[model samples]
Target chain A: MDYFFIIDFVQSLADGLLFGTTYALIGIGFTLIFGVMRKLNLAYGAAALAGTYVGLGLFLTFNAPPFVVFLASAIGAGLIGLVVYYCCFRFTPEAHPMASLLASVGMLLFLEEMMTHVSHGMPHPYPSVLSGATLELGDIWIRGDLLFVFGICVVAMALLFWLLYRTPLGLATRAVSQQPRAAQLCGIDSARVNALTFVIAGVLGGTAGAMTAAAVGILSPIIATGLTVKGLIVVVIGGLGSIPGAIIGGLLVGAAENIFLLLRGVTERDIYVMLLLFLFLTLRPGGLFGSAATRD
Target chain B: MKLKSLITAGMISASALALSSAAFAADKTVRIVGFGASSGVVGIFGQNSGAAMSAAFEKINAEGGITLADGSKAMIETEYYDDRCNAEEGISVLRRIASTDALVAIGPTCSNVAEPLFGILQAKVDDAGDTGLQFPVFTDVAIKGGLAGISEWVFRNTPSEAKMYDDLFAWIRETYPDAKTIYGGVEEDFAHSRFTWYSVMKTAAEAHGFELVGEAQWLLNDTNFSNQARGMRRAEPDVVAISAHPFTSCGMLREMARQKIQPKVLVGLTSSSSLETLSGCANEAQGIIIPTSFAPVNDEAKAAAEAVAAKGGALDLHSAAAWENAMILRDVINAAGIEGTPDTLEADRRKIRDGLAALTTAHGLLGENKRMPDGEAVKPYVFVHAQGNAWEVVHNPGS
Candidate 1:
């Protein structure tokens, strides 16, 4: 390859890594819920976008800053996560996993339609915290917004790690994830753990959504389904319930997508990404960091 | 005394008959159905167009409505339905409207929906074996090329991108002779943007002596444009064209700015000449030119814009077509000389269709709209550029 082509490839890699932060955030939300209940909350992406819309509404109404909007989005998403858990999972008999899955899908459509109704399907500009600011490293350009999103993702991942490894709630969550019956016998309320897990995942999803909108500088109702599909792909390739796997899978997918986009143009880019997902499913069913024990 | 009583009863009966006939004549209303994505993604198009159509109808009714063949004025009534920008919903709405007393139907804001929706319409005007609905469809928004040729019953009051781009390139060649090379990317998933870019825009640019740069096609709703931006920056063309919706357009433009892909000229899809694009990326979209059929620069367009605004709609090119279409409907109805009655609804619809087919031109907000042989309009358009959070008319090739 020519030097210019090499430089372009490196730039693509860097940009993909930055973009991967969002996928990781969304994947983490799915992995967390799956880790707790062994059921996928398909409405997670919609709830995340709904949270962002809520943040947008607050920002428009009160002229709040970007940070305030992001905070509100996280909190709003957490509440929506609780609602989804209650409606889709809490009362449903776990005998059929499809029931909860179908319920979450219904919830996803409801949230998307609700947003479309409220926003009138018009795309609104999300406040870019550091728009038009770029850091140049020789031949490569780094977007300031993407950098900020990357930083936020790192901080969020660290906080999640700290919460999971250095807190009593973490202990309860792990116990429930490992053996719900045994944990319940030991007087640990699995239901509370699951609900709390959903709340945490929801907050992550909301922050992801806000960060994504900020990165793009525009938010619309159309992002919900696309994000959900990406999140699902990330989770499956990262190993269904493995947190670290989700992060790795997200980066891998992002990098692969950019590389494929460079090679085959946009029309064929997603086909390659989907093929990669299929390959991973067929060859490495346990994912990069996951083992059979991690599988639901 | 009995003969006098019989005369009194006869007189009373005659008065009752006259009053009933007068009431029937007063209640005469001409119905038109409008359907589009009024509630989902891209609902703004439907909402705006529906509002503009309503405003036009309101003005028409206030100005004595439409005079039918019998010399009686019949008020125009519109029923708007939400198709949600989906093909299934588009067909559903078409079926429902076809079963009504509507003289004509308008809408379906999306090209994807329009593609299939137009297919189910009667192709040759009266193909008995086809079993297609013989409803006259006057599309306002769906702007994919050649859709008007799908059925004789279908007509579109949308800007022809081929003509618009051809004129735009010719104007660009004259205005900026030094800008010879063009690098661009299009949102491939969107049918309108993709088809326009592949069929009209590239060909027009090439015909106008502009060389194209690297292969770059971006997906619709793509948030990241790093690879494409890098490619464009390397090509270092004089102009960069982007065919995308406002949301993706803003994203790509922002990325281009970040990557410092500064070209001498920036051109965008005609669909991007809207308040949404301005609000989404005001700084990034600066100096981006687009050809638009509707701008508030002209007095008539300004008045129509204000009217639409008053009715809670923004008058962009797509929505502005609705206003012109409503007036065109009135003109066609009058020209067709249809009797406005429920019993004659089918015949009246055929007359309206034939009237629309016979129309060679209609009055547009800007000027006279030229109708193609295939029931499409060649609307007068002006080149506009984004300047500090607003679209300003930069060039007017007067009609």
Candidate 2:
């Protein structure tokens, strides 16, 4: 193989892996919610972006700092998550799985339309904390914002792991996911736990949104729907309710997407992705870390 | 009994007068309906187009409107619908408009929507073989070349991108004699971006003695351009031409900055010559040149720009074309001696279509636009470059 090919391959992989931090962040939100509730929140991406839009609004309205913007994004998305929970999942019976799913789909459209109306479908420039910073590692270059995103993802995931394993709320959430009746019998409020789970996932989603916008250096309503789809794909490939699986799946997807794009082109990149999804679904329905018991 | 009879007679006379006035008003109003994507990724374009149309119509109405077939003063009435940039929605809107008392229609902003929507129109005029919708569509936006030739019933006011890019590259070759190598990029998912990049931009650049060094592609919604920027950096081209809408174009430009890939010259798609690009990435987009059909260079253009801005819209090439389209429709209504009434709606529509088709040249915001044989317009254009968050004209070929 030519030296240029090796260099190109390594660069593409590095690019994809770094960009995959966004996918990982979004996937974590999906996995966390699904792990606790055993249900999909289709409006997750929209809610997250809605929070980002709130952050953008704050920036535009008050000239808020990047840290404040990101914090506002998380808090705002957490609030919207509660709203989504109440509207889409709270009233619906647990027995009717499709009801909550359909309601979330409706919520997705509602959020997208609402944002579109508010912004007039205009792309807003996002304030990046690390703007135009890059590190040159020999011939391959790494973007400063994306590296910041990667760092944020790692710190967020570490905190998430600690929260899930080392807290009373975590025990209650695990109990609820494992057995709702037992958790309820043990004096745990399953409804409260479910709502809290959504808030947590929403907070993560908000962080993901802020990071994504900051990395891209622009925010628009266009990314909401596509983010939702990518998040779902990551969730499925990462083994549904498995957080580790989500991370791995996100990185794998990112790397594979870039490599495919480099090799074939954009036209067939998505096809390869879908085929990979099919392979996982057909051969290992439980995904990398998902037990068969988690399958619905 | 005599007093009651007198009062009854008075009421009858008053009713007769009111009825006659209402009928006369109805006869002297021409209604046109337009549909476009008012709620999607590119929804802003449609909104701007709609606003410009409203502003133009308002101005026409304020200035005594159009003269009718019987020398009566008739005002123009317009209605706009949101197609959401969807082909099915566009077709549905067109069908609904066809059933209305509207004498003509406008828009279907996206080329993807316009292509299939135009296919539904009657292919040939008065053809006994083709059973398509017999309505007039005056497009203001969908700028993919050769769309006007799809049907006899459809006409476009959009500029020819092919000609624009050809002139642009020629100018670039003359202006920057040392710029020889060109790198290209496109949003592959969009019809306009893909066609302009592959067919117009590449052909023009090569024809002007520029060698193709590398090319990259991305989706309209894609936010990342790292790999593409790396490739561009490797190619080390003198010129980088990107065919994309404002969103992806800004994204790519920002990525290029991050990669430290500074090409000597930058050429952009015709559609990116707008305020959106500036608002999105003014710093990144600086020095990128694009050819556009409209600029507020003259008094009339300035007034129209202000009018559009008053209506909360920017006067870009697309929206300016929409404003010009409204004026052209007015002239067509007058020249065709249209009878603005429900009874003559179909015949009036046919007359408007014929009038539009028969035109050789029409007044544009910048200058006179030649109406081509295939129902397209050859609009006058100028080259503008992004500088300090604003597009300043660099060259006026006409001048």
Candidate 3:
């Protein structure tokens, strides 16, 4: 291979790894919701973008700092998550999983259309905390904003890990995910736990969305559906309800996309990624960390 | 008493007849329909065109609308439908409009929808057996090079991508003789962006003695363009071209800036010459050149721009075409000399189509636009460059 090819490969890998953090964040959101509710929240991506838009509005209105904007986006997205649970999950018949899934899809369209109406489908420039800062390591140059996103992703995941494994809420969440009826019989409020799970996932998704916009340097209504699809792919590949699986799946998919992009062109990149998903589906069916049997 | 009652009844009957005739006269208004994605992700295109057409119709009606063959003046009225840039919705809206008494129709903003939608129209002028809809469609925004040729009943006032790029590259070759190497990327998922990049822009670049640097194609709506930018940076070309919608263009340009992939000359797709690009990536898009058919530099264009702005729309190349199309429809309505009546709707539509076919030239904001035999418009265009949050006119080849 030529030196240029090697350089391109290295660069793609590095960029993909950083971008994978975002995919992991989104995948974790899907996994968390699935773990507790056993249903896909297709509107999670749209809700994330809606939160980012709210943060952007705050930034535009009050000239808030980047950190504050991210904080506002997370909090706003958490509130939207509660609303989604109320509308799409809380009152729906739990016997049919498709009901909640379709309801989430409708919510997705509703939020996307609402954003389009409010913003007139215009893209806004997202503020960056580390704009124009680059770190060079020999021949490889890393973007500062991407590094910041990666760090944020790591800290967020650690916090989530602690919340899920080391806290009283974590124990309750695990108990509810394992046996909701038993948890309720044990005097635990399963509904409250489910709602809290959604709020947590929403916070992560919102942070992911804000970071993604900052990374891309623009935010628009167009990003919603694409992110949802990506998050779905990541969730499926990482296993339905496995947290660590989401991270690994996200990284694997991200690296694979960039590798394919370098080898083939962009037209064939998605084809390969989909092919990988197909392979995982046909051969494994349960994903990287999932068991042989599928969950409800 | 019987004679007095008969006289009262006679006066009442005469007054009722007069009022009925006056109401019939008042209802003889010319109606047109507009349909496009006025409410979705890419809603701005449809919204802008609809606003511009509405503004043009307002102006025309204010000055006394089209004069019919019987010397009766009719006011122009428009009904707009939101198709949401979907092909199925486009068909549904077209079918709905076909059942109405609309004289002509405009829009379905996306080229993908327009391609299939135009296919369902009557291809031959008078083929009765085909049974395709025979309504006259004057598209404004869908600019996929040869879609207007799909149907004889269909017409487009969009910019000719072939002519625009050919002229642009020729000008670039003359203006920048030292810019020999070209590197660019295109949003491959979009039909217009992909087709124009491969068929017109790249071919024009090579024909003008510029060499391609590396393979640069990215998916539409892709936020991360690091790999693409890094590849281009390796080539270090003098001229970089980006053929994409405003959103993708903004993302790519921002990535390029982040990667420090500076080219001496930056050329962009026609669709990127809008306020959206400036607002999205003003710093990164600085000095990017694009060929466009509309700019508010001239008096006529300025007036139309102001009118569109008043209706809450920004006048870009695509939207501005709607203004010219409305004027064209007015001219056709006058030249065809059709009586604006519901009973003669089909005949009026046919006459308008024929009138458009026979029209060789129409007034454009930049200059007189020449229409091809294939129902496409060849309007005068100027090259503009992004400079500090605005598109400054760099060259007017028309002059």
Candidate 4:
């Protein structure tokens, strides 16, 4: 191989891995929504970009200290996620799956348009949370904020595990997701549990958006759209409606994207990731960990 | 003064009569139609540019319509069309403007659009024996210099990025000889940014002793810049030249900051001088140096730009060129005495065409034109270093 090719290949993987951290966060958001709501937050990516805008707007206005800006972004996107649930999912036809997808897509456009309108259809600069505070470890260098973001994602998912398995609210939420009519007949108030589950998913998405903004430092409508696609890819590869599967899928998507870029190049990089998704969908329809246990 | 006015009047009418005396001799009203991009993403730039031209035309009319070849005068009339900044749409708009009884055209913001429009203008105005379509035109801002060879029928009032960057690098070398070893990526999808990034900037850097370190090409719609950033870090260049628009550049710079990679000397092109840069990159965006044609902070240019802004227009160095362009067009028209009647569109366009091509220098919105030997006007540009959260004018290389 040419020296240039070798160097480019290695660098491409490193770059893909670092970039995949953000995608992992986005995947987590999609997984949380699917696990709890049985719906896709088409606006999930837009929520992230919108959260970035929220964080950026506040930062611009208050010139607030760093962590406060991150909090603002998280809370901002989380609140928007709740709104998307309210507007797009809450009163939807029970039989129509496409209704939720279409509504989420509409929310996606609305949020994107709102962002463009506020920022003059231009990209807004986002201040990084821990930009200059990274540590270099061995052959591979780890970015501090990305490290923090990945750590936070792990923690969030772990806490989500605790809530689903251990907490009473989590018990009710699971019962509602499993058998809504049966849970209602059992007097569980499935709608309330479902709404709360969406709020929780929204919070995770909002946090993901905040971390993504800090990691990337620029937010555009394009981010919202890309995140949605990546989230779907991760969800499909990981197995839809499976939390653990979403996690595995997230990491796999991240590492797979990196390795793919390594073998091929930037242009062909996404092709493999996409191909992997298609392959998984065809060969292993239930995905790596999907089971009849997840069946409604 | 009297001889100048008399000559201006005489030239105007003679040119008007030469176009088609039978058509204009019957009508007192003269139409001066305008064509340009009025909607879409860059709609404002196109709309404002045409409006700037019309503003000048309005003042000319208030003083008295353009004097004909005889002592008589003809009134000013206008028509405006929206090109939507689309290539095919631009061609259709030109066809539409040609159909209207309007003389000459202005606006349509980009070179890709303008390049095709130039071909159309050339075939109809210059190459086709002045039949079917023959209207004089003035280019406001389409930064690519490819059109210089399009036709003698076409002319630009703006400096090409090649000349601008060449001068910029020359000044940087003269001022900071220590700067060397450059690495960066250009926005490949955009013709203007790509051509400047790969061709003009690299050539200029090579000539100035700056080593070509590395390169990555990003598309216009690219949001995530992980792959590109890592490439730049691996390159470890002394200077990073990112030639892209705000959305993409901000994303790239943000990733660079997040990765904690720092380069000693960072330089951006003139086009990057915008409020959007800060809005996109924030704190991580600091320390980057960009050469800009105008800063609202630049007293004279600012005052003039502010005046335009006050009249419902925003002024950046890029947009500020419209004022300079309009004033230059006026000087050319006044000197050449372009006939403005609808029928004289052909003859008047030729005068306008010759006037623009003949202009060595005219007063600009900035300082003196200071025409170079190569016929390019060296507009004033300054190096503004992004300090803290704002851009501070660090060097006035122009002076």
Q: Please report how far candidate 4 places residue A291 from its true position, in Å.
A: 4.7
Q: Which stretches of candidate 2 lie over 4 Å from their true place?
A: A294-296, B1-23
- Native-to-model Cα distance after best TM-score fit, residue A15 in candidate 2, in Å: 1.9
- The digit string of per-residue lDDT tens for model 3 on B318-397 reads 99998898998998898899988788889999999999999989999999999999999998999999999899999999
Please report how far candidate 3 places residue B121 from its true position, in Å. Answer: 1.4
Correct interface contacts retained, every candidate: 0.84, 0.63, 0.77, 0.44
Residue lDDT tens for model 3, A231-296:
989988999899999999888888888999889878899999999999988988779987554333
* Count of clashes, each model: 0, 0, 0, 8
Give residue B52's lDDT in candidate 2 (0 to 100): 95
Off by over 4 Å in 3: A291-296, B1-23
Candidate 2 C-alpha lDDT tens digits along B283-303: 999999999999889999999
- Chain A superposition TM-score, candidate 4: 0.89
The candidate 3 chain B region of ten consecutive residues with least summed lDDT is B19-28
DockQ of each: 0.77, 0.71, 0.78, 0.30
lDDT (tens digit, per residue) of candidate 1 on A1-296: 89887887888888898889889999999999988898999999999999999899988899899999999988899999999999999998989999999999999999999998898877888887877788889987787888999999889999999999999999999899988898999999999999999999999999999999998888888899888999999998998889999999888888888888877878888999999888888999777766577423
Where model 1 places Cα greater than 4 Å from the true spot, the runs are A294-296, B1-9, B127-129
Native interface contact recovery, model 2: 0.63
Model 1, range B195-313, lDDT digits (tens) per residue?
98899899999999999986467776687877877788889999888989988888889888877788888999988999888877888999999999999877988889999999999
CAPRI docking class of candidate 1: medium
TM-score per candidate, in order? 0.96, 0.96, 0.96, 0.78
